[model samples]
Target: MIDSSAFQGKKAIYYTLGCKLNFSETSTFGKMLADMGVVTAEKGERADICLINTCSVTEVADHKCRQAIHKMAREHPGAFIIVTGCYAQLETEKVSKIAGVDLVLGSNEKADLIQYLNDAFIHRAEGTTLHAFHAVKTKDIKRFQPSCSKGNRTRYFLKVQDGCNYFCTYCTIPYARGLSRSPSIASLVAQAEEAAAEGGKEIVLTGVNIGDFGTTTHERFIDLVKALDGVEGIKRFRISSLEPDLIDDELIEYCAGSRAFMPHFHIPLQSGSDMVLKLMHRRYDSALFARKIALIKRLMPDAFIGVDVMVGSRGERPEFFEACYRFLDGLPVTQLHVFPYSERPGTSALTIPYVVDEKEKKLRSKRLLAMSEEKTHAFYEQYIGTERPVLFEKAHRGKAMHGFTDNYIRVELPPSLARDAYDNEIMSIRLGGFNHDGTALKAELT
Candidate 1:
């Protein structure tokens, strides 16, 4: 049994890696600890507990997780360490052997972290080591733990769904996160209401496969959108990544005229070559993706569209890559998130005979990245003289305050006007040319 008094006044530090979903989960965990009277540790201070949320989207990500764990262990000596997230779910044994790790929790098990921490503290007080592991098999991961929390930024992330049913050939997400699952629509709306009550102005819907929401409940994604649109006090809402085939006409039409939904969309076009997409076992083809982009442009011309493109997967011949580049060049997307493919163990991708060399993969990624910059710059230039509603965030380094427009353009105000008074406040501002650093567009009061 845990001593209830043991948790009071304890200091804890959290380190999170990977997607916005992980950040939301970490935030929720922080609240849980806070309720027990544990406070966040200050920078460079040793804490009584250390929690690390990890990601394993790629081999490089796995290496980073390992490095972060080692660094945390060294910095907070004698603190009870807990590791969880996708990396821990897939590599329980490997994470368990890490020198300072006291416990390993899987995707599902992470929801019950408070109880595990209590047990760990009990064992520690008795002069016993508590290196425990708890993980549910992928197929058996059914519980959906809802999370709605703010990051260091102004916008809050609401996890509307979790897990994925479509296991792409080169992906390990389904293995690490489990099948599609989500809580009821009423539950999600309640969470959104709570966020609004807390003075949140923006909320971004996050999930492993959000468009595939309503797997557990009989609700549809469009229905959920309509319900959230009725939420008051939230000035903005942005839909994260959606599958191409799932961006139905109804959803697109609704967002174009919705009260709070912003004019921004992130759709993954893993590859522009239909042949390569087929090898990856992606449900939709390149033509379908192109049509979706065209429809979005037709409905909301000024909307910012972001595309995720992975280069150099197995069997992506030179001609296939050339075709992909051409297809992307013809699209009207605002930005391209380019990544070089990384092979993972136990994936069907290894059975494919062809493989792009490292040099070629890097070259391909570089080309796409250059194209992405050009596309984004042109998109930003188009609205140079226009006025848009921008929600400014807190200033950093006491320097400049940055914010995003309704269409997702990053804008910066001069340090002179970047006052604390403007933080989290939405104002009409005339967009100007690039700032001194060229990282964001300069803005002036309208």
Candidate 2:
């Protein structure tokens, strides 16, 4: 319901923070504005409006949200700034206090942004008044429904689920995101098919917790993948991040055989010590997590496995940290995402004893990062001289094209294979060697 007459040809810039869910929502918002005859512009360019989709996962994220607002305001003083997402939902007062933010919308009120902007513009034209929608309770607002697949990407992130149910002592996601919810299987398949037809080679299923997908009728995650595997045109499918407990043998078996599914898994293991996991309120222990990895290896030995680890957390001493290092070193994971603990307000972890010192935290982080590099190199070395299917995306930085193998290995193509046809096209690439960062593989067309 944007006022087309007041700003018929105005341009808008969108900045998204946090996960793939935020990106998907921002894209939807962009499309909605486009339908209202508003043009889209890249960030830092002159635009009439600036929209920020924010995150509140860590204190650093909060700082980034403020920095983005200040930076954008400095660049374009006349533009109207609108803020939405988890940060706005939980910290509305803090966000509203920022210098150039004109309107602050909660997570649930995001769908009404277009209408709100129209009203604001109409009032401004009449010189009547100015208003702001801040501190709107998320529970009172209706859900902003997701749209169909109208936009396209070479690798599309289809958000089939939202929110979380687990109340981890060290997390605030449950409060910010609410309970778990998922789209229907019929709707998901329709979206996937549209993305496939739109030249999307891979569809990455993303959510707060994708493993907890179906809540409607107890439908399993594998059931959803089975439906997506039948969709035509999409040559590959991947999952974002899943909980260790949710990954069962059945899901592993399905991905092992499915031609469309990619051989990759990213599971978060916040702490490798069972005692520390208990304090963090994680459901599964390290033993169970290791078993899950073993099962995956048994099915697909060459699978690209990624694990998340917290470098420093409550109740983690030197001995506990050693246990974590030993556990991960023995695993066949391709890489590790190491996060140093950053305390958030209202989380039980903030009150725990034996909090790691900043110096020690950095040391632990560096150690784990070195382990990640070694593990990644070893994994890539195993794939030397192997030929895998690579979907080359647009060429960038002077005739170099980049793509990925089915197992999520980053493949770079030489100038010979990097023709214009490589854009949004899938081709076979030979895994010739590894770059300095073993996560990336130097490839030639096979």
Candidate 3:
């Protein structure tokens, strides 16, 4: 047993890198520390503890995590630095060996953070030089730890699920996060209710494989969507990235007419080429994906559809790249989240004969990104004269405030009209042309 008094008046700082799921978990960890009387360290003040949540989706992500670990150690000398998340889980030994990491906790060990902190403090005091480490030898995704982020941000992230079951080639998420699992729909609904009661107007449902919800609970993803739709006080809800195959007609129909669900969808179609998708071991083909997009647009024509496309993967010859480019050109997506495929160790993709070189990978990625920009610009241009409701987020007094429309269009209010009073309020606005930078649409109060 540890004495709670030892943690009183401790100051801690948190840094998060990667997806919204990591942000949600970091908030939960901060809350856990707060309950133990740990307050956030003031700006420029040295904290007694440092917590880093990392991501390892790609080789570049791994390099960034290492740089972050070193930077945190240098800035806050002697602070009890702790590292966790996908990067820490997958590369436990390497993270533990980092100069300033005092403890390396795996994905499953994060729930018991306080106890680990106590152990770390005691060991450090006893002149133990070695870093403390705790992780499962064989990953277990069975445990479902519910987390909701209620930080200073305008939108709250509700983590309804964790882990991934789809072991796609060229991916290490399964090895890092374990298999697919999620909490009961009833529990997630209760969490959304609590967030609403706390004045959260927007909540983004986050998960490793959200469409695979109820892998453990045996409830369907559509059923979870129906339950959350009934939660009052939440003005907007957005579903995160989901697999193309799991998106059924029932769910699309519900969101089309639902009270709170937004007219936004982020679907991952890693490759537009059917052959490349087969090589990647993705469940759905290009035809099935195209059908889903068509259905969503038919029901919600003004919907904002975002796609995830990976370029230069194994077996993606020049002809396949051209095929993917042509296929995407025909789609009506609003945006594309593009990235070059990185080789992850211990994956089946390494066995494939053909591999894309660095220069070719860069060229392929550039072509796809250029195409994505054109589509996004065209999508924004179509809604220039329309009216939509935008929920403005909090911003500094002198800075321009921004918000997202129901269809996920980013609208900016000029600095003159950006008042503290308008923060966190939804209002009707006439959408205008792109602002000075063409980054977002300009808007004015109706």
Clashes of each: 0, 0, 0
Q: Candidate 1: which stretches are off by over 4 Å? A: 1-3
Instruction: For each candidate, give its TM-score against the true structure.
Output: 0.99, 0.94, 0.98
Which candidate achieves the best TM-score against the true structure? 1
Give all candidates' CA lDDT scores.
0.92, 0.82, 0.90
Per-residue lDDT of model 3, residues 1-446, tens digit only: 97677789989999998999999999989988999999999899999999999999998999999998898899999899999999998889889999989899888888888998987777766888547777775356456667987666889999988888889998988888888888888889999999988888899999998999988889999998889989999989999888998999999999999999999999999999999999999999999999999999999999999999999999999899889999999999999999899999999999999989999999988888888889889989999988999999888878889999999999999888888877778899899999988888999788
Candidate 3: segments with Cα more than 4 A from true spot: 124-130
Model 1, 89-123: lDDT tens digits are 99998999999999999988998888899988888
* Ranking of all predicted structures according to lDDT, beginning with the best and ending with the worst: 1, 3, 2
Q: Which one wins by lDDT: 2 or 3?
A: 3
Quote the lDDT for 430 in model 3: 94
Candidate 2 ranges beyond 4 A from true positions: 42-44, 128-131, 134-144, 147-153, 216-218, 397-399, 415-417, 436-439
Candidate 1 colliding pairs: none
Q: What is the alpha-carbon RMSD of candidate 1 to the true structure?
A: 1.0
